[model samples]
Each structure stands twice: as structure tokens, then as C-alpha cells.
Target: MPQIILGPSQTKKIDGSVKKAGYAFLEKLAADDAVPGLHIEPINGSADPRVRTGRVNDFYRAVLFKVQGQGDEAHYVYLGILPHDDAIAFAKTARLKVNPVNGIAELVKASEPVAAQPAAEAAPEGGHGAGGAAPQPPVHETEPAAEAWSLLETRGVDKEALLDLGIDAALADRAMEATSDDSLIAAVEAAPQWQALALIDLAGGKPVEDVRADLGIDRVELSGDEETDEELLAALQHDAAKLQFAFIEDDEELRKAIEDDDFAAWRVFLHPEQRRYATGGYNGAFRLSGGAGTGKTVVLLHRARLLAKRDPGARILLTTFNKVLADSLRTDLRRLDSSVPIASRLGEPGIYIAGVDSAVHSVIQMAGSEVGAAITEVLGSRSPSIGGRTPASNWLDAAATVPDLPEELRSTTFFQAEYSMVVLPERITTRDEYLRVRRPGRGVALDRRKRQLVWQVVEAYRARASVEGSIDYGELAAVAAAYLEKAGCGVVDHVLVDEGQDLEPAKWQFLRALVPEGPDDLFIAEDSHQRIYGQRVVLGRYGIRIVGRARRLTLNYRTTAENLRYAMAVLAGGEYLDMEGEEEDSALYRSARSGPEPELVPTDSLGDGLSEVAGRVQRWLDDGVAPETIGLLVRDARRAQELVQGLEEHDVPVRVVDAHRDVRPGRPLVMTMHRAKGMEFSRVVLFDVSHDTVPAAYAVDKLTEGDRADALLRERSLLYVAASRARDELVVVWRGQPSELLP
Candidate 1:
């Protein structure tokens, strides 16, 4: 049987009519690439004999490279679709070969010089033949000349080494010619996966041997001296090569890659580094940290599938900080492979997906009559509550009743942190326990008298909750953890956590207690820079140690380079710490795509800002961007509501996302910054981010210097999350002076 290889650059966007035609084209190739209707003809005067043009229809043509494998079977690599003349022109100047340095298969244009065209800034199309934009030229070809300095040359990476990394010969010259980091990255972005990564590391001063180890080069046969059919096939099988080329094994997989908009290429393709973490064996708990869009969640989902498939009866719990994100994980897991077993409940024989709180609540429900005993075991006098969560107003009421409480300790912000960081996780029940427990990450220091007053506030808060028959999620998780610890820690064989940075220590304890200490026991994916909820936490304190088992992913697979820069700029000079308290930086983070610089439109008034946003959104809609894929994010619910009314007044369709985070169809989405977490859009407008609006006066107004700093950091993170949600275009509109968070 013949195989059909799909390239990452299959540029035609997928829509209903195009999808039908794309399926017809793929089905013909699957049956036989030689099918007469495809009109697979060799390009005249092409440098490589394998280069051919195939007809998808009269309006579209596929550039292909025909390679014959073992026996009489032939495999055709589908490069991309183009118009008739363009396809022929591209085929004549393209060649497919095994990347000699990295041993991965790659397609490169021939050495024959052609006029360089300006690259258009746009989002990548999801599938085949729907989007109307033509493929843009490689960045290096279109980028203007730079100065005399070279990023790789300064680091002693010569052209020979560049070639050894499998960069195309022409791109290798461009890489060496690059004067600045931006130009170098633009050049590397045009290289194949392993090659680009090698360039990034080499330029970052990583030794060549270390780069080789990072690529797992020992496993692949590398030789630039020869090219063969067997080598091409083996190169195609290499994990890094799979990022740009997928060899479909079945019709269902084919449909997913070519038909479904929700089906991302990353689901089928894995970078070598990501593949290592996803399938590699770890002796204990492992944590994967990366900047936004760096494929951490991708690794988590793949790892869950691997564990479930490795052992049919494996009980795996895949969870996150909230219900919405956890629900997204479940959906992505199914989209990754629907056949992966999904358990109906905890401790079952398949992967169980839920929010950490939901998972804890399930433990309580499972415990039933025994849950009261578990709660008593963890919180001493506190029994399980039936009134659900104690509301925010209850905290203010509790703080007011406590006499002589310091003004700094009187706010709901301080009390919530005090409870989550020291009280609940430390299992503090009495005043003495609260007074004695250490608050490691808290910014404010408390002496004996201050501790005594803080304890009074804690006691009053608990009393109020007890009288109302309600408890916070922190206590709920603590109770669940105590129950699981007593139950002997095999509730699930493996626990996978996403958005691990946003989780409080109590939730971490619950997760640690859910899985036993052993190989592949716990897998966590987090980005501290994206942490917008809760306070800083140290995982080691919660028994989830990842001292040597942690790795960072730096390449962003989502947002464009221009947008990523703007988003990262939002965090400039702000201190961000990982789950273990070490300061974190995204210095090495880079994006795979490039687009227009994020627009910052400053207006004299709110009405003007709204008009500017509505006009841009209308233009995007006119350009064919889907309405549901356009997000109008703000810092508060009031601002979000204001955006809905403002956009509607301009005669643009819009809808406000409710508390459920339900994104309705056929309309632009208006959501608060916090609600935008774990969501992405084709285009995003951050509406009305004025200086007074962003740190959200209520969040930091009445807090201490230390508490104010923490609140400010969370506010910055909120804006960062909102900015990174944009996949292509990002616009920041301010009513007056811009937020200090903006660059």
C-alpha cells in the first residue's frame, strides 16, 4: 500500500466546500498517486527529477515530491497548494531530501535565484483549501540586510556547523549573515525543526556536543555525503522530521489533519524535545515549565495517552486548576485520539479528567459518611460543610469582628493568602498552630503580637464559615488530601496537572496524595509567567518535588513573534517565581511565526477607544476572520459588558461570555482578562486598558506595601495572559493614558 505524506505548509484553509475537495484529493493520493485525474506531471527544467505538480482542481495545484520506497510502493510528499502558474514555478525550484546534519527529511527550494517578495503577516491556516491567502515567502529571503556582526559567528558557529545542523545551504548563508538576534531568528525560523533548534541553542552558546545530545542525534544516522530512498524514509520516521511531515496511517487520521479546524498539527506532530518528555521514563514526579504557547499542555496530553496505552488498566488522573481548563484538557485529549480510554470516575481503569477541586470534591462524595471523619482528621474541630464556598463578603465580616487587627491584615486579600499559604496547608486549627506555622512565600513579616491578631481574624473567619455551614476550596482540598493519605495513596496510578502554577498548596497536596510515589507518578505543566490566580507556591512543600526532573520548553507554537514580544514586554522588570520559588525568565522564548507588531491605540475618551476597537473588529470580519475567533478582553466584568454594548452600537455582532465561559457561535466574544485564560483567538482587542483600570483599584487599593506588590504582579499576569491569547493579531486600546503594564 502507498503512503500519503502531508507537509506542514499545506496552505489552503479548510472550509465546507474546500474540505470536500481536499478529501477527494487525499483519497485519490491514498489509493494511488498515479491516478490520471490528479494530473501528476513533472515540472519542466526542475533541478530535482522528483519534483512534480498535481492538480487538486483547475484553481488549485499541489506541489509534490515522488519517492519510491521498498518494493513497488511509492510515497508522495504533499508540499502545499498554489495557483497553476505558482505551483509550476514553485515545483521547478524545489527539492526534497534528507537533512544530512540531523537526518530529518526536508523540502527546500532550489539554488536558482528568483525575485524575493514581501512576506505577508497572517495567521496559519488550520486545514486545506479554505483560507484565501497565498503562502508567504521565507522570512530570510524577504528580510532586509543587516550589519557586520553575526549571532552564530560570535559564538563560534561556522557555516560547516550550520550545515551539520541541517539548515538549507542558502539559509545557512543567511544564518551566518545575520547581524542581530532578530535577523538570526528570522533565518532560523525558515530552517527545519531540529536545525532551527540547533541554531537557537548554538547562538545561545550551547556546545555542539550538547546540542547533539539535545536532538538525540546518536539515534539518527547523519551523513551529508549521500542521499537514498531508504535514507529519505528513515528521515521521515525521525521525530523532529515528523513536526513538518506526517505519514498518515489511517483514514480517520487523514480526516482529522485535513478536515477538523479543532485538530491542531501539534496533536500529530511532536518536536524531538517534546517527544522525549512525553514518552520518556522518569523515576519520580516531573514538571514541565515553559512560556505561554510552548506546548506544555501538548506534552501533558500526550503523556497521559502514552501511560494509558502502555498499561490498559492504568488509572490516570488528568487535572488542572479550574473546571473550564480541565474540561478543555478532556476535549483536547479526545481530539488527540478518541480511542484513548476515558474513565467515568476517579480510581477507574482509564484516564479520569477533572479540575483539582472537582477531583477533591469527588473524593469527598466517594467518602460519603466517612468524609466528616476525614475533615475532622485534617481540620480538627472543623466538620465538612454543606453550604458550599464561604463568599468573599464573609471574609470582610470576619475581619471586622476581630478586635485590634492591623489595618494591613484587615483586607480580604491578606486573609485569603494567610489561609491558603499558612493556615490550611499547614493544617492549622488553633491560634497556637497558626502562630507557629511558617509563612514562607508571604511578603509581610509577622511578629508574635501581629500573629496573635492574625489568628483572631482566622478564628473569626472559620467561625463564620462554621455557622454558615460553608468551607473554602482550600479546606476542601486539605480534607481530601488527608483522606487520600490515609487511604494509602493509590487512588490513581498517575496524576497529570496542567496550569500547575495557579494551584494553591492545598490542591497540590491533594494531587500528591492521589498518586503513589513511583515512576511516572506525577506530571505537571505550568508557566509561572502565566499564573494569574492564587499566590506563589513551592511544590516541594506539598510533597511534589521535581528538583532534577524538570525541564523548560522555550519555543512558542501559538502566538506570532510580534505579539509574543508585546506580551513578554508586559512582564518586563516584574519578578516571577516558579512553583519552587526560583525566579523565572522567558529570555530564550521565541515564536515560530511572525506577524505585524501589536497595535497600541490611545484615545482621548472611552467612546473613542470603543469606536477604534469596533472598527478594527469590523475590518477583521470583513477580511473573513470568524466572529467566534475574535475576542474583546477587559480587566473586569463591567468593562466586558461595556464592550458588548459599544460593539453592538457600531452594528457589530457580539456576545458577553457568562460565568460558565460558554463561547457562543457566530458572534465576537467579550470576556474579562481572568476569564480569557486557556483560550485563544485569531484576533484580540484588549479594550479600555487605562492606567487606572488595570491594576484594578479594588485589588491593590487597601493592601499593605507587600500585598500591593503581589496584587500588582497578578494584575500584570492577567494582562499577559490576555495578550498571549492572541494567535495572530493583538490590539491594545486605552481610553486615556495606557496601563503601566504596557511596554
Candidate 2:
């Protein structure tokens, strides 16, 4: 027989006559000490050795082997041994145990019983001749097989555990098969107290009293229904009882009261300073700051309504970042108070709701006809002259020819017509002479040169209009701020500004000009997280004190935890820590329930990508997601055109919501993120969320131009706007490359 060592403590023996080549390999390994721990066991009798002829080839066989020290559980390793010579070399190189020949002997040796006692104890008591009375013939006493079977039977219990406690498996199986809950109870009746507790826990701890009643489980109590294992696990993991809100039973009434034209409800709800704005105190400027889901818009509307109620003749202004939201606010306000004459326009005497451009245009319009005409002319001249198209620069050149204009008038074409210019007199110049010639006087006279100079200066102002028109939203805010500061319009009794975080430093300066020098004159409400557009601007730079009165509405009733998790996953970049007690309820279902999980589809071509997204929209429509509830948000208008064409080809009704369109009831909206702020939908699909798109390549350099803090603030705010738009579901789909913002 050939012997082989398996491990440090095990060995196997095989008949040497099994094969000549196998015996030769074993002899070679034993000589080389490759088969360590090899030991031979003596055989009592010898017989003719039988030659093993057949060999089985199972080369891929790998075994998970375990080795244990005294009293310790085994540790496992996946050991692969091949029969080939190369495998023998590889095993040696890898320092693993190997037996090329008689490998079966090694395996058998490893499996053989370990020695339990010395050979001296192997003989029976009487065989050794020293044991007294030959153990009295071993006193044979046997219970009947039937009696033994009866002793093994159990009434009821955790059959497996009971069997582990020495009950027979057959008895335990029979006990488990018995009918009725009582059978289970009887089986567990003899179980240890700890075993009973384990069984109860496995059965969901039913018939057990809740221990946290004093802390109150009213908000998150389990319904009197059976729960699955997953649900129970979820309950155990979440502190559901901590997240509860005082139910507002009369939401309709509250919304109605907010919309009331009478301003009665607002008086009761608003603080004293807010009441001023709620009651037609629109002359002053203020800012509103608060977390998302709070009633910032509600206060804005109430202020508008109060203005309308206090003085029907006064013009109230309401502006936001997006036109759709402005229109929606208009609709909602109109629905609430039909008596208020609300006009969505600039320079309107009633209530005006618009975007930033509309508001600035209103101020420009008030500058009079000459200023307006010059602005038009300058814009036309400065515009590109491609194909001999009207060049906006021509208008600018014509206006620049004007001279001796006031500095303020020189900056804006709109300043040309209504107001005359007066140079501030120096020590050498007489103030009276300057006032006589340029100050607002009923019968002031001027020479032809001075009058012509004034006209030319007015034209110069028109030239500046083109420059102003080229400025972006942030620049416009800066320009507005400068204008307000130079004009010295003292603050009024009350000033209320909406979407405060979206305002830039310049815009804040302009707002400050509207606030009178008094305590509590300014009221600001904003969510820092919702500053989607104009993130380069900081609310604090606007110079408003954040008092302790700042309120945060943290509850999100609109989105489920799953939907929010997906949204945050796409936007958070591992930086956002979900606050305690902020988990969204997963049970809240959307009206349109069917849709594909938001996908990260890949396509080789842009056209294919567009087609894919368009197909998804069509499928959603077919699944009964109302066309109006579906939105295709792209990064820019150029990309939107392809999606629009695709939708049209599929005969799906779609509307591009830009500055021009009035948001209606049934049309689906397609727009850029810049256009979607302050508006929400039942479903939102943010497309082109790729790195090159979202923080669009152009916005990347903006951080270098603005304060780093302000830029980051604005970027986060923009993402907030995109996130809040989803009332039910938010799907962010991207293709080609993953967004840099993704984890």
C-alpha cells in the first residue's frame, strides 16, 4: 500500500498494486518530503493485492475543504486539484498540498477515523482476562420497539428544535403535521422559555402588546393585518412613529381663505409685518425665506390680493423665475379671488405676474416713448447683420452720436425721452445756473446747442439699451440694483419679495431700495436648496438679516421615499445627508401607476437617443399617464427640437413651454431647466442629464467669475428647482456618458 499525507494531521493509505505509474509517483513524492505528515497504519491480515485497472477522469472537480483545531469550528478553502502533470507543477509553485499519484489514497486517509484510545483498551473486558465477572453478561434489557416509538412521540412544539432536544425526527414530523393552532401550542408547551420567545419572534411576535404606547404610535401604527417578513424588517429599521404631522382637515378651506380677495383670512394668519403687505402695503420691498413646501407663494398671493383689496387703483407686481409658474400662480389666484382684476403684463395697473424680463421691461416702459423707441432702435442695430438682416449695432451707432447726456441717461436708451440731464455743479460752477438750465422746472429755457445735445444724449441712452439687452439674468439683476441705488427711491412702508434666493446681489440692492427705514418692513421667504437658476448669487449678499423667526416646513407630502431616494441619488453626489425623520412614505401612490424605471439607456447616435426618449414618452401616454402630466425637460431648446419632432411624428400632442406659451390644462410641457423653475408636475423626465449638459459646459467657468460660495449656492439651488417639480414621480434619464454628479 502507498501512503500520502493530506494536511498537517491527516494521511491516507492505498493498495500499491492499484497501478505501477501511480506507485512510482507516490514513492518519488515521499522521497522529496512533498508528502509531509505521511504515516503508515499496520494491517492485521494480508491478502492478495488486486490491481486497480479503471481510472475515472473528473478534472474539474474542486472541493471545499475545512480544517479545524480542537473545539473550534472549521475554516473552509476551495481546493482545486487537477490530474495533469502541469497541474502538479502549478500546485507545487502555489505551495498547495498535492498528490499526483494515489490522490484517492490521500483523500481516504484524510477521511479515516482519528485514534480515540490506546490499543490496550481495544479488547473487550473479559478478553483481557482481568475484568471481574465478565461484566455480568452485559445485563441485556431492551424496551419493545413499539414502547420506544411511543417514548419518542411529542404532542406539539418547534418540531425541529424538539428533535434537536433528543426527540425522534419521526415524532417531530408527525407533531408538525397535526391540525389546528392548538397542536402548535401543545408542541411548544414543553419548550424552554427562551425557545418559546424565539418561536414567537419568528411568528411576528403576534398576541404581544406593543411596548411603546406611551410614546404614541398613532402616526405609524401597523394595521390589524398580517405582515410579510420584508414589511416587518422595514418597520424594525425605520422609526416611523417619529414622523408625524398635525393633519389639516380643512385644506380646501385653507387654500380658499388664502385665495380670498377679502384678505380677511390673511389678516388672521400673517404676522404683523406680513399683514402690512397682505393689506395693500406694496410700496415697500421685502424678502421671504423658508424651506420647501412652506407657503411662500401663499404669502405672495395674499400680498397681491391685499393690494388689490386695499386699493383697486394701485398696481401690484408679482414676478418669479419662470413664466409657467407665474401663469399658474395667476390662475390659482384668479380661481381664489375672481373679483381681483389681475393682469399678466408689464406697466399694468392691476396685479401683474411675470418673469424678471417682464418686470424690467415694465420699468423701461415707464421711462416714456423716446426711451422705448431708442431701446428698440439700439437693439435692432446691435443685432447681428447676417444676410443684411436688421443690425442692432446700427441702432447703437446712431444713439452713440448723441452727446452731453446725463451719466444715468447715457447708460440706457430708455432714459432719453422723459427726463432732462443736469451735471452736478463743481466748486467752480454755480448750482443755481445748473438748476436753471437742467432741473425740473415748468418754464425752463435752453439754447439750440443744449437742446440738441439733450436729444443726442437721449439717443446715446438708446445705444446702451442694446448692451443691457445682451446681459444675462444675473447681469440684469446687477443692472437693476445699480438703477435703484442711483435713483434714491426711499424704502416704503412695506416690501415683499418672492423667490428671494434666486435674486442676485444687484436684485437685492434693488429690493432694498423699496424697503423703508423701519423695523419689520421687509419679509423674505426662500429655500436655499431651491435656488436652481442664478446659483451664483447669494441671499446673504443681498444683505438681509436672518432672524430667529426663519421657519422651515420640512414635511414632503408630494414625493414618496422611493422617488426621493432616486432623485437624491442622482443629485446628492454623496454630499447630502438625509435629515432624521425625513423619510418619505412609500405607500402613497401616483394616479398614473405604470411606467418603466428611469433608465440609463445607451445609444451610439444622438438621433437614436432622441428616438428612444420619444418612444418612452409615447409608451407612457399609452399607459394612461395624461399628456399634461408628462414633461420632457431638456438642457436646451436645440435638443428639444428633435424630441418635439419625434413626438409629433408619433401623433403625440406636445407643447413647448417657453416665455411665450400660456400654461394650459391639457398640453404636455417641454422646456429647459431655466424655464421649469417654480413649476411642478405629476411626472417629470429630466433628459440630457449628462455631464456636458447639466451644469452645461458654459456654466462650468461661471465659478471663476463669481464668488466660489455664491456659484456653489446657485448650482445647488438649480438642482433643487428640478427636484421639487415632481409631485408624484421624477425620472432622470441620461445616455452616452454618465453625469459627473452621479455616485
TM-score of each: 0.91, 0.45
User: Every model's Cα RMSD, please?
Assistant: 5.9, 30.8
Candidate 2 positional error at 158, Å: 34
Q: Candidate 2 residues 570-670, lDDT tens each? A: 44531221111122222121111112234446565566666776777778777777777776787678767766886677676688887776556676788
Full-model lDDT, candidate 1: 0.79
Where does model 2 exceed 4 Å of error? 1-295, 306-316, 322-325, 341-493, 535-543, 569-608, 665-667, 701-720
- Which tens-of-lDDT digit does each residue in 1-743 have in candidate 1? 67888775645564466666766787788888667898888977997898778787778787778888676888878776777888888778676766544566766655532111111211122211101112224445344455367778898888666445444455556667767555666766655556666666777667777777767664334443446777888888877677778887777777777677646458888888899999999999999999989999999999999999999999999999888888889888998888899999999999999998889888988777777877776666764675579787778887788668887778888888878888888887788777778788898889999999888777787777777788888888998888888878478899999999899989988888888899999998999998888899889988888989998888787898789988999999799988777889767777767678899899999899888988898898899888999999999988987888888899987988866758778989999998888889989999889999987999889987888898899998889999999998999999778888888
lDDT values, one for every candidate: 0.79, 0.41
Name the weakest run of 10 consecutive residues (lDDT summed) in model 2.
Answer: 128-137
